[model samples]
Target: MTDTHSDDVRPVQPLQPEQLGTYFALMEAVSLLQHQVEQQLRAEGDISYVQFQLLARLAHGPGPLTMTDLADGVVYSRSGLTYQAGLLEKAGLITRGPAPDDDRATLVTLTGAGRALVARVLPGHVEVSRRLLFDPLTDDDVRHLGDIMTRVRDHMRARPPRSAAPRKRQRS
Candidate 1:
């Protein structure tokens, strides 16, 4: 452990048992929720969670966005996103084309098929989401959980992994 004030290294202290238990419980909850959602998506839509996410992003956004923008927005690696895009294209769910002004950038957009898929799958998706997320929590619990997660996500966004000390954010 490094002293927060002085930066002196010391032996790291483990979390108290209760703290560890709570942490593990939170992780378990997240894993279970994700698994349930994934199962529902696969069963109902024949789409992996990642693919569904990509389609959902395109369907929800205002307009077609660049590949880089999609990659960043979806928190996916460039290569992985390229492969997923190919699958989507093959399925006639989305189209990839060159950006009109920027020859280097590829833009992605949903086709009529993709929009129809979203419209088709959304009811089951919402049902599963509500069953796993909202059904177990009170209104106040949901609000507090949302607030806490938002703060946690923002803090993580500001601080990159310690393995890669953050560089300055780049503009598109």
Candidate 2:
């Protein structure tokens, strides 16, 4: 009889070299761009990437948002966003007020200083983004990349969560 634990001893299927190459290229490109932007923001302005993103989001927001709403807007985890919010609050870049409807939740708003900072940094940020991301790509390439990325994102989102059981192998 087969041992019950045999189910756990599955052979590993390696990704094809091309698939691995694509994954690495995408990751490296994103990492390098993020590092470059982070350095620029730090050197030109005294702000961490998360802090910059938080301020930028708030500046563009239609109205004040709770910490949870801000976290969702920026796709950050709630705990990390809260910590960043604290830093911004300490810097006088943002203000937290008791939510009118909900005493428990605080509404975060960009202060005048925060808005000014975003206005000051936005030109440089746009130039950097254009230089690093857009200038190199042809208009067609930009369109194609956007379309492909959207499709990939949607496809991934549509997939069901992975089961706890090991994935079954496809038969030839």
Q: How high is each candidate's TM-score?
A: 0.80, 0.77
* Candidate 1: pairs in clash: none
Residues 33-99, candidate 2: write the lDDT tens digits.
Answer: 8888888788777898888888998899787888867765566776688788988999899999999
RMSD each, Å? 5.7, 8.8
Worst ten-residue run, lDDT, model 2? 157-166
Which pairs in model 2 have colliding backbones? Answer: none
Q: Taking the tens digit of each residue's C-alpha lDDT, what string does model 1 give over 57-102?
A: 9999988888888877777777798999999999999999999989
The numbered model that scores best in TM-score is 1
Total clashing pairs for each candidate = 0, 0
| Cα TM-score of candidate 1 | 0.80
